[model samples]
Target: MLGIFDDLAAGNLAGVTESLARDVIYENPAGEQYAALPDSGVWRGREAVVEAFRRRAQLVDVLELQQRDVVAEGDRALVVTYQRIRHLLTGAEAGYEASALLSLDDEGLVRYWRVLSESAAEADVFDSDLDERLLAAVRAGDSREVGALLRRGADPNHRETATGLTTLQTAAGLGEATVVAALVAAGGDVHSADSRAGGTALHKAVQRGDLRTIRVLVEAGAFVDAVAPTTGHTPLMDALWYKWPDVVAYLLERNAGLGLHTHYGFSLREHFEYELNVNTRGKDKLLVAEQLLQTRTREDERAAGEQRLMAAVTEGDQAAVRGLLASGAAVDERFPVLNGFNDLHTPLLVASRDGHTEIVRLLLDAGADVNATEPTFGAVPLHKAVYNGHADITRILVERPGIDLDFQGATNGYSPLHDALWHGYEECARVLMAAGARTDLVGHDGKTPLDVATESFGAEHPLVRELAALG
Candidate 1:
């Protein structure tokens, strides 16, 4: 009976099946759920018992097994064993400590068996030096050495000295999938919570948008809805923060539950809206935020949608420009109450500064004043484009019929050509020149294009040479 228990622990299915009585019954937990034996159900008969063991084998490769304790009385035996099971594809291993009760008939063939496995604390396998070696291997991304050391009886769930991070948590936090896979292959506790943050590897993968790592963790049976301690943020929150739409979709597909909320009293969707509005300010940020908000909510979802759109136009999302216009979003939406960093500019001025040509075209097409000046810069779209060296957009703006080419803003006495030449935009200068920009124009510095070019780049540079050759 003791020998039969040893064979079963070793995953020697054939030996166990041969030794068991025809009426033997075996019981264990359901597949991929837990390690405990089924409470009520039992597999009856030798062939049925063999099939049960085979099904359990399919979940993980039994790399090694060692009996820690065994006691026998007559034909019955009880044994405790530590076993390592490796994930076939990722090579990640999970360790379990299990106790099995075996009953044998008069023929010395096992007749009944039940096994119960449970999770253990990290201190069970701690060795001071082995701990350091594992941490170093994980930090350096040394997958091979990590795997070998774990195989040599090193603990996969060893905690670091300073940070107290389990190897899995540290490796996953750094986005080192190789180290993570090796640790998992070595029977590391994938569900081990980080000492500091209480988040798991799955949380780390979600935060960084490492989709491959997420897939690996998930396939290794990591808890999908594992939440961080500090923020109570779930993997979904991490995905949304990093803008990983595909990861969000994948987690959702995996039946990941979503009661995730921040300490600020906001859900993941609301958090996304807040981040899109406040964290992102520039033109591109606003546009992406607008689209992102739409993905999370409906059109009549006014609070977030309106706020995002206002921020969008203020930052210059071209599609938002068209969408707002079509949907009657306020064109002159002002932020007078919140004055610091909240000064409002028309969408056209925002488009000009960011060099969003399509947005500029949309605003113009939607009846925006092309010559409207931003309050601070006092520069119109042409002045903004020329100042920023937006050569193509400047060309487009100047080429518009009935547009004022010589439009002078209040801040600078210089025309569009003066701004172009001062900014060293040779291509813009050429375009302005081709558009009949004045060669004799003088700026606030009392210098022409040739003078500025010669002073800035020396007469030998192409810019100065082009200006000098223009004569």
Candidate 2:
């Protein structure tokens, strides 16, 4: 199965065609539209299947199958695939969740091939001159061409049968306001559901973070609260996940639901907070926080402060870091109970782990304990800096008074030097050695730095020479 996927991804047609039986039955009931079209059908025989594929190449610029699962039982396999297509004629794109059942002969040739998909609306094998021209115009953002096509009797709401996407959906997804406005003026339906996940143009706009195109659709009577029937995702929820502040603000102004639970079972506020906490963009942190504040009730203030501080450290926002510290954020505040970090991280540990040298300096200057150990790993901030090969951070920690150079972490498994050697951090190892890191010290396994160095890179490597010189 993996070999078949590899062949398909690489466009190895011979590899694909050679594995099919001479009289194989390729039955695609969902592709009935293609049965009436030229050179397309429930192809029989290896020769007919190869010809069907040759015809398929005419309409597609790109075809990719993202494999999700493959379950095999003897000679039969049930395969789940996500199909992405870029049409050559329309220059439009579409994706579908597809399932296929295959029967392979004892000789490993495919004998019976059957397929099922979520919707027949996404069956895009049928093609015409007008359909391609209309979609190409829409995708290119050519408002004049789109208007011309509409006047010449093109369907303003014409959907790519394979992707279940209308011209408006593609325009909105691409953030083309001019094209969206042109289609809207020509009677495009803003609320039409797509075949894949039943998403409308508004959903696509929000998903793409296109404020301008979103406005055009909203003004054309697109619903702000419209949830995708398949995914149950509102445009607001999509905007929140993407960290689009302006989109979130606009949806809020339009009375979009704030506390709606996502498909993941978390409320919008919880998802926004998670996004804010994990985001590494400094400026975006503030914007997302402000959006959260606007939507958050007074009960969310306490947790909001901690999230803000953590976000600042995550982004290496020096100013926000100083401000949060000045405004009474605890220097050693613990990460929340369920934040998914393997260790309980303070701001200093987080900064050092992220290689934020300036933030690490700031946190240290603001009274962050350099030797403070994470509760889970029993590892200090310097251990993290060494593990991540932060040379500047290693220098900074070593320069500080009372800093432990050979602190054994987590039942004394790997000292900082041992970790540096094991992970091939030669520069950090050199820095640690220069800062009076003991060459005689061994880890819990009784292996010295030189032993680790010789084992990791052999005695001939430069690291062994450095560690030996330290002794």
Best by lDDT: 2
Please list the residue runs of candidate 1 whose C-alpha ends up more than 4 Å from where it truly belongs after superposition: 1-128, 281-471
lDDT of 1 by residue, 1-471 (tens): 566556755778888777989999877644422322213247899888788777656545567688889898878788898777664433555677778888888888888888655443211322224556667887788887777567656687877657767878788877887777777887878788878877888887777767778888989989777777788787877776776777777776664544346876997667777766675444354455446435433422343345554567556677767887788765544322111233345666666666888777776776766676654445677887888988878877877776677766666567777787777787887788788866666766677768876765677988677666777
Error of 2 at 191 (Å): 0.7
Q: Tell me the lDDT of model 1 at 277.
A: 67
Colliding residue pairs in candidate 2: 122-162
Error of 1 at 36 (Å): 36
- Cα deviation of 422, candidate 1, in Å: 83
TM-score of every candidate: 0.34, 0.36
As a whole number from 0 to 100, the lDDT of residue 259 in candidate 2 is 50
Model 2: per-residue Cα lDDT at residue 128: 31
For residue 210, model 2's alpha carbon misses the true position, in angstroms, by 2.2
* Candidate 2 lDDT by residue in tens digits, 1-471: 346655665667788788888898877664434332333347799888777666666666436778889899999999898867665655666677878799888788898877754433234433335555778988877878777666655676888888889877888898988888888887889989888889999999998998999999988888777878766788987887776878877876665655566676677667767776787875564476465547544423445444777789887898999898888778877654332562257888888888999888888888888888885578888889988889899999899988999888876667888888878888889899889888887788889989998998999997798767767
Q: Which stretches of candidate 2 lie over 4 Å from their true place?
A: 1-128, 282-289, 292-471
